[model samples]
Target: MTSAPQLLTDPFLQLPTATSVQVVWFTEFAGVNHIVTYGENLKQTARASTTKLSRTREDQQSRVASQNQDGQVYQKPVQRDIWRHEAEVTGLTPGVRVNYRVTSVQEDGKSVDSDVFSLAATPKSDTPLKILLTSDHQLKPMTAANLQKVVETVGRVDGVWFAGDLVNVSDRASEWFDDNGGGALFPGLQGRAKHEMTHNGVKTIYTGGQIIQHAPMFTCIGNHEVMGRFARTGSLNDEFDDTIPRVVAQRIYPDKSLIDNSFNTNTYEEIFSLPKSKEGEKRYYAVSFGDTRLVVLYATNMWRTPKLDGKFKGRYREAEKDLNNPENWGYGQVIYEPIAKGSKQYNWLESELNSPEFQQAKYKVVMFHHPPHTLGDNIVPAYTEPVQIIERDSDNIKAVRYEYPKDADYIIRDVVPILEAANVQLVFYGHSHLWNRFVSPSGMHFLETSNVGNTYGAAWGDRKREVPIGYQEDYVKLGDPNGLEPIVPTIAPLLGEDGKPMPYIASNDITVFSIFDTGTGTVSSYRFDTRKPDSEVLKFDEFKLKLSSLPLPPGNKFPG
Candidate 1:
């Protein structure tokens, strides 16, 4: 018997062009007909194209109904059937709003419909906009509360700029569609989440903001979005942590396709329909929104366990049993894609910086996943490939370790110089889940406003990072690894236990969010303490993206 078709997520907007926008949704069964009904009277319709998700799966750890039965546990990753439907509604007038809803007809002849929502085409150049800046919402406990506060405080936003790390695991169907706890990506963003929080014996349920249903969202690739070598193991978590470099994978299995041997962002790439670069389809690209030129880059790498116990493969070394077998090595936090000097990504960025669209825009913003300046611990060990050093006692291999040279940090040594030279106004990123900002002498601003869910303690004062002792390369334990002073929040900075103003808001109970107002050229950050359910969302920091006074050097142009 064919199971009843059910809509998994409310319809959301994506890839808004000047005259059209894409409406996307998910369903459990392959429906007979799926479409978008738009306009004031909902008379017009556009048919949707449906495709099955390739690698989404569920394991014992999944929170789905089947896996929730008593004594029921999937020992291995089991494929979960999910179908994505996307319809392009074209012939829209720029800056005009229209009512829209999605409907799916089941194979059983039954139909499902979503609540009516509003949408619009890309805004005109003169149209002022407010865009939400957030990231690292890995289904953390506070994500629902954080998003709930956004709607209450800001009311409505035009767009959402997500820096990355949408969920804990990209291929987990429940994490994206319907985690029983209601922390799934779609539920949290479409006001369907049922996440609950308790304080002082008082329990409150939080439904995340109804933002994406009305506005479009643009995102970059974060470390969490990339899944490791295809599921060869029973545990999805193990496969996620088992990625090797493409070069290494090729050497081990020269006969196999790269996608089959190495890591991939297949699930992520399949979900969104964004503007593509000639070099990078959706992995990296640039888009023009209103008066702003937004350049998204793929600059994230595989994050490994920081432990050095020699029992597990980690950021610093290979596991003891796997050292002898070359195919099983983790390869020490290897980067997924190359963006160093002379690389394809770098060349594309150079062309984008010099292009008329970027140079003439009123505001220039570049976004990626890794931080170039931060007070958090993730910035340590440098943003470069790890150097391997193996120790052998006469015949047998004794130990294998990796080191990162600080001077060879690509983002700092190469990317930053080009961005600074291009007079890029803002650099937004989030790898460290904290709220902090820094300004270079050249006046470019770097902000990390990813304190949306939780935080890993910041590195300052007596607080330090977990760096291996006696390593050949010296790692900075405190402060920004690239050497820039953190900028204190302007309106209301958080105070430490010593009564001194701290430059960051790294709290699990208090969540932070930011909004960029294009009309004022200012990015404002706000925070809400979930402990106090009725507390006001306090505006903590505000900074303007000012055009630098320095001029491009004479006869010094970006090389193609």
Candidate 2:
């Protein structure tokens, strides 16, 4: 017998305007009626528009239903039907919170109702807002613990600025709703997770903070959010890693849509209704939230494996067997979208940065996926498109390799200059799973506070990235490749083995999170050791946003 149809996720707030906010929810069945009930007595109702998800699927590795058994339920990737319902709760009083709930009635007359939650329209300019600055959850180990501590420490946040990488696989349905392990995206953010974490031989179950259900969340397209070419027979992971440059895809499949042949963000775009830009739609856009003007850029590229033994297609070279076929090449971490000077995204950004809205805002912030400056390994090899170099023996191809020119690093060479010139206060990003911050010479702050879960060890002193040693481009094995020094935490920085303060927190046991307080003009970073379930959350770093255009020397210490 089939189970009863139920809601896949709790209603979450999105795209908050002055007088309205979008309430979005999901379900396994296409319901006949889906509505959001709000107001004092739950008398007000808004009918919802339901649409089926296009690309969500489940593979053998998925943790759902019978798939969670010892043996694989799905031998190959298969579609998992899911429907999304969204309703705009209009005529709301700005900053006035009201109780709201969602209900969906199936074809058989059975209905499911979500728990009552509080929501409000956008706040006023002078309103005090504590926005969560986080990214790279990707259903990692400590994500539940990290978010749980967030609620315990600061209560509900006014908004969420998620830089990217919400899940490991963009089209995986279980990863977003219920992964069975209780670390799914919706569960973690909606306080419905049952994720268990064990440290020091003690076990604890964590329900992530109740945040996004109340406050709207804005997200960027991280590399993990973009799935490559579609594959009907093979593993979903193979299709995810099979992305090619648009130019190459066009040359190969002249009649196919770029999204179909190259790569697509259909699932990510379908999940969130974010503010749109004239040039890039939801892929990259700018939104005004109270005292802040936030610009989110599509500044991430395909992340290829770093292996170089010719046994796998990696960041530097193609696999030996695939060297002969141009269509099968990984293309060396090619960028998905161009943000270089004169490009569409760059032009839009340049205009947005100079616009009256951005200029007048109390805080101007830019967010993206890839790190412009970080101590983690993912920052190396530059952020520009790879230059393909073919090695041929006579007429036969021997090997296919790629190189990145430091001068062509788009984020560092193009985007940062424009942001610095416009006096952007903060540049937030993630990709490298670590907590690090840097201040540019023009006093612009670069913060990557995404140490929410596991970390790939930081590259400093003795630790180094696995960069190509004898490549034409000089990849800096240590320090920030963009030539900026990371700022040490102003209070209680984590100590290294040498007993000195470490600037970055790259730990598996201790997770970190950051809050951007618009009222105080400060961003405070906090950390919690998951190893000690009952331990206090420590505020490790806090820095005031620079208001003036005065140039600060590189590596200038932040004042407490």
Candidate 3:
């Protein structure tokens, strides 16, 4: 019998390129040497240990829940230092089977080897491509089932793109590593973790299935992935102090510098090596796979919220009246970035959009955390521009403070025009957790399929909430009570052969995901009822994408 390495987490694939793929794993100790051996089979292989860097999270803690002797659940804060190792294996033959494993040497020089895994590089440009698109998997009861179903429905996916909210709290190590509650993220992604969920006193165990171990995984930044640091250390570990940045920022922003100074998404920046632009660590990037080009945008404000946190009495603090120092100012400011002209992200995106690689590709798709258009409650805050300046109680018990924005949100005022001009066929986003699609006046497709986890309810028809006081007219002028415009008429209520809307495919409780197959030029939407474990993965909606029909620049090659 052979013993596996003392691995904290199983090896997962990240940043797969044309000739190399970065493999990452974690252990308990620093200074431990690790190597990744790769080849066509497990028997013959090449080894690489060319890079090693140690990371420590002293100011952060991982929070999880555990039951007491009396069966009462409470959060357990683990503040252990983490040591992660990443090794990039190069010189691989594209579109061919490759086997690999990670071996680590302990302080005593004893070597530990992980289980062997297999994968192939991303397919070449001329080959057909299959990609899984989903987002907002923040440890919901059904997240494990969502990733497992991806593999069950689509046998082999070239890549997986998560549109943000990967974890509930970016800085909580346990939420990412080992939350005892149903939300442990790593366990769900690697197929090694199961969630014990209790619904109405009925306990059920959910076994997570593998997804990233075999294919590369990529993600963008979401509001949940941002955190604010203040006061003492361990007390501010979870989403308690985290949500303050977002919810508070909604009402105040003393100055522009305060936004970036107070909130940070550095935790997400530390774990993965995402492709970046000339400006280092910019969350957005672009890459080409097969015949299509993907442009990822990180256009989300973690501190931007439409309302205050009502869960805890002290959660919304109005401790400061002047709002000068962030430490003294307790919640009520919308943390955001200006993505209009002259912004770094805007410049890089414009370059990517006009690049030869992007314009020449058969398909151009852009992914971001916020939905430029949505049929959900989130769209209200997402689309609203600040209009007045007044102040109220932090807990929403009082009237409110209103400060009008000097300009419109960059996405609505600027980004839309750029994307429409570039002829970007599809704009994929997921902040509002529902399944819906909209087409602009110029035939550009806008799709939101974030129903991968639990939904925040639909923002359409009867499900819409009353517009906040003083905003009714604004919403009515925008489109509807929820601010959603006309959905593509054909798929409004996607029907089955029975001519009825697909059963259990509504916004809430219905876990959903989508796959784009470049080979067939089709996008298929699948959904499952999280409440029913026996629910089948049903295809609810699909659309064929004809590159020739979509408007493209005049001087581009059309691959038939």
Can you give the lDDT of residue 514 in candidate 2? 97
Model 1 lowest lDDT segment of ten: 551-560
Check candidate 2 and list the clashing pairs. none
Ordered from best to worst lDDT, the candidate numbers read 2, 1, 3
Task: Please provide, for model 3 over 1-560, each residue's C-alpha lDDT reduced to its tens digit, 9 standing for 90 to 100.
Answer: 64544776778888777777888877766545778877855554444342222222323334344432221432343345666778877777788868888887877677778888876666688788788888888877677777777777787677788888888766556677776665677788777777765555666676666767777877888877776643223443433343334445444555544434456666678777777766535477887878888888877754333443332212122333334344434334343444666777788777777678888778888898887876655655433334333354664334223332314556877787788777777888887777777777777877888877677765444455434355323433133232236453244354545675532234445678899888887788887766666668878677766463553465553331
Q: Model 2 residue 326 lDDT?
A: 81
- The CA lDDT at 504 in model 3 is 22
lDDT of 2: 0.90
TM-score of model 1 vs. true structure: 0.97
Model 3 lowest lDDT segment of ten: 310-319
**Best of the two (1, 3) by lDDT:** 1
Local lDDT at 408 for model 1: 94
What is the C-alpha lDDT profile of model 1 across 63-125, one tens digit per residue? 877666422767678999989999999889998899999999987689999999999999888
